[model samples]
Target chain A: MNLERLGRTAPAVPLLVLGLVCLIFPLLVLLHISLQVRGGYGLGNFIDVFSSGVDRAALGNSLQFALWQAGLCVVLGTPIALALVRLKGRARGVVMSFINVASSFGGPGLAFAFMLLIGTTGVLTTIWSQLFGQAEFPSLGSMIGLNAIMLYVHLPLYLMLSLPSYALLRNEWREAARMSGAGFWRFWRQVGLPTLAPFALGNGLQIFMWSMGAYAIPYVVTTSPASIDLISIEIGRDLESSVFGVERAATLSVILMLLAIAMMWIYRTLQRRGERIL
Target chain B: MSAQTVAPLASTGTTTSNDEADSFLGRWGALILLIGFLGIPLLALLVFSVATAWSGTVLPSGYTAEHWIGALTSSDVLSAVGRSLFLAVAVCVINWILVIPAAYVSVVVEPRIRPWFQALAVVPFALPWIVIAAGMQLTVKEIAPGLFGTVGLLVLTLSGVTFPYLYWAVENSLITNNAKQLSEAARMSGASLPRTLLQVIVPAIRTGVMSGSLLTAASVFGEFPITMTLIGGGYETLPLWTLRMFSGRVPGAGAELAAVSFATFALLFAVSLLITRIDTATKPADPVRPPARIS
Candidate 1:
């Protein structure tokens, strides 16, 4: 029972050491790469990420994209989550499965799938053309199309994050409110909306953090002049580009990691508050 | 209580009736919204997969088995599926091996360190995929040269990136399981820590392990960036094969694409059902007992 006594003889120490070593390798290697320069220590790469106009633009665009995607995910995802809790029977299972399966459908897969739906020769576009007599169908590469696809891609995660809170509401309570001459809006105002607030906030933070690191979805969806640059894309480019040093790529990566950490801290804080409120 | 007050009672009935109608409408409205959100995209994928020629039309010209046939017959496509499946299973195994022990230590050994360990394990979630891919590639190429461009690399990278899915499941089970009781009981009966773990703790959390494995499998199966960067060219997974087929409009490309999507979709659905079943099976076991004292 007292494993701590065996801690001296236990193999757990060695195993823990190995696990820690494995975990730190990637982070340390990347940091080492970031600090390495042309045979000496230098802050050149970090400077480039901050000072360069193009790098600045890419970072700005990525943040903007992340913001839009996060906002859209909440708008589209919350209603479906609400529906799942309120709706009953076999229908709920199917809907929940759809949300889960489709949520696992990544950016590239969904992008191409949507291309078949909304491309120039796509079914929806052709219909729009026939109805409106517009010869040219809009590209699926448009910002609206990209964001819409990403929103759907993220639906499952937000739904899961919100479901527990939604489940806290008792059906008997709703029925009682109805019996007492209370209507749906009256019940919702007094009960449902208030309970859902913390869930919405916590889930919204997760969605935001997820969208900020998003690369694959945007990469596969768009090829417009407006789309060629983002921090992730730039890092990939710099990694491959002989002209740019690896340190610059590393610096950009570090910046991305910091941004992600900040977002996660915000998310964790909100989650803690939600847990407390519950 | 006069005739004027009685006048308000008549309006109350009208408003109540309207409220009933509005509530009915809202419920249906909510249902329709959810249906569209989940259904439209899925239906789109299904239709696209079967479409013979979907050119500039609201619908495809016709449906065919051509793509499905092509996908099944192609050796390359078949191989990609095989590779993906193998890697996913490996990812599942590796994740469970590390996650179970790490989680056990966190849960049974020292509850004080549990939160810190959990936070560290899930750090992968917030980290960028591209960064992970890059780090994985460098690590594999330098530290484990033979692993680069192989299924092993995929298993390792994916396990690291997705282990949190398993850790979450295992931790939830451990906390709710009163693992202390089970292990204590086993130890009292002369079971060693490892045996107690293998026989008692592991079985108790089997559902969690299954769910986590399913989740990690699904993730590894669909993963692209890590597979692409770390494995490099030549050894393409299903997604990479699809990507190549996409870039180069090969003869069987459409069918290959459809096949891959449908296969992945089917796999995901199956895994999700499996997880749902596990959760439901475990549901009754829980709420039967309260949380154990933190001793």
Candidate 2:
């Protein structure tokens, strides 16, 4: 097979170098810039990130938003996933295609869709106003509002991500439970939920990381500072503020990167556990 | 409700009349929930795009095709679409050049380092786009100021961000198809290494390559934050154009926004169709369950 010749001829070294330069070097630069203060390297910028009340609030808001978004996505997506697995023929194909399309609805396209449906002067908002004989509907403001919008974007994604795991559920297990006189609820509560917990948790954490790092949707939806403030927006704001804000932006980015790393680590662990169970 | 008490009666039939009713109700209920939640907004967007005016109404007050025509015909919009298409295609090509060799070598020649190489490839997914853009912006400004605000820097940034999709696709294809055996076979038949890779390995994984490129292109087309932050006003992408419509940069641009939204959806739909086609065509005769840990 000429394995040695293949090894000698492969561009392994160049590929490795390209990967490092493309993926790792920018992160290293980010870290380096994050440490810089007053034209010299120091932890002062990170200290500023930790000490500032505004920065702390932004971080808190981001975590809260991500938690709620991930929670809602799981709550709403799991049942749909279960039902989807039960579907057959044309219905399954149509629903699956819809999910695929919806999962791709992120960033600006999704924000625009929601705006058309629920924003001020939005279609649904207008419909609600007419139904109640009111002039205007209440604005979708605050962290809860942001969470709702995020759920719309992320639910299908979670559903698609979790579908494969649900497919792993054996029908024989259900039959066995039913034969043993276990009711449907008991069968699911005792066996189904426990078996699928890792996949659900893993998908939930992935959603958490997704919303945590997301910038575009929040950027488009939340126009006022009085609304929810996320860390992604805060970083963008800082970076655009002034030359000095670059360091502060870097500091916040480093923090955001750390949080993402922590969440991803947990997600990977849960995914591994889920795989082992399967 | 008390299944234990009714166990003897229920044991005679798994699907009793009551159970059939429940299943029917449950299925319809789920369908309604799915459609109402995900389908309605998209439907609204489509309606709005074609409507002449949607202000102060539950539905658009009037219908018109002007916005669709405007979005399709406008020079700025057309240019933005072109730019996005060009950038997406360029990113796909760059990623292909970068990832194909890396994936091929890792899979066929250096199996031991596959894990480490995969970890490196996935780094972009972990880091937030804003953070990467901020850092890349700073780095480019400092090092290659000439390339700043040019398509050249954007090509670089997009390549980094979108590389993982193609890499994973190619790697998965290589592993699942057992490309090494084919490469080895080709080598045994007196084919050189390059010949083996180009003629044997690449063809074997063509589906993966096509799907990966399409996925990469879709992501790049929709990307906004990096384009907005790093190369703002340098080159307007389609997403940026949509953003401008929403921001009221152009007066009475609601119809245009709707058109762009629909267009984006169409693009997304087409990509999904292609992906589905590739998936169905390449599906193994004997299905291989994907390892859970791979994702």
lDDT of 2 by residue, B140-222 (tens): 77787787788887888888777777877888889889988898899999998778878888998999899788878877887
Candidate 2 lDDT score at position A254: 83
RMSD of 2: 3.5
DockQ list for all candidates: 0.38, 0.47
| Candidate 2 ranges with C-alpha deviation above 4 Å | A1-9, A38-42, A135-141, B1-24, B284-295
Candidate 2, position B282, lDDT? 80
Mark the regions of model 1 whose C-alpha exceeds 4 Å error after superposition.
Answer: A1-23, A35-43, A135-138, A169-195, A223-228, A240-243, B1-24, B138-150, B284-295
Give the number of colliding residue pairs in candidate 1. 2
Best by lDDT: 2
**TM-score of B-chain for each predicted structure, in order:** 0.82, 0.88
Per-residue lDDT over A1-278 for candidate 1, one digit per residue giving the tens place of the 0 to 100 score: 46664572342343244335445567667777776767787776787678999989878877777778677667766666666777676666666666677776774556667776677776676777788887554455455666667776676677766777677667666656655666667777887676667668767766766665666666555557645367776766565442675667677777877777787787778666655655
TM-score for every candidate vs. truth? 0.86, 0.92
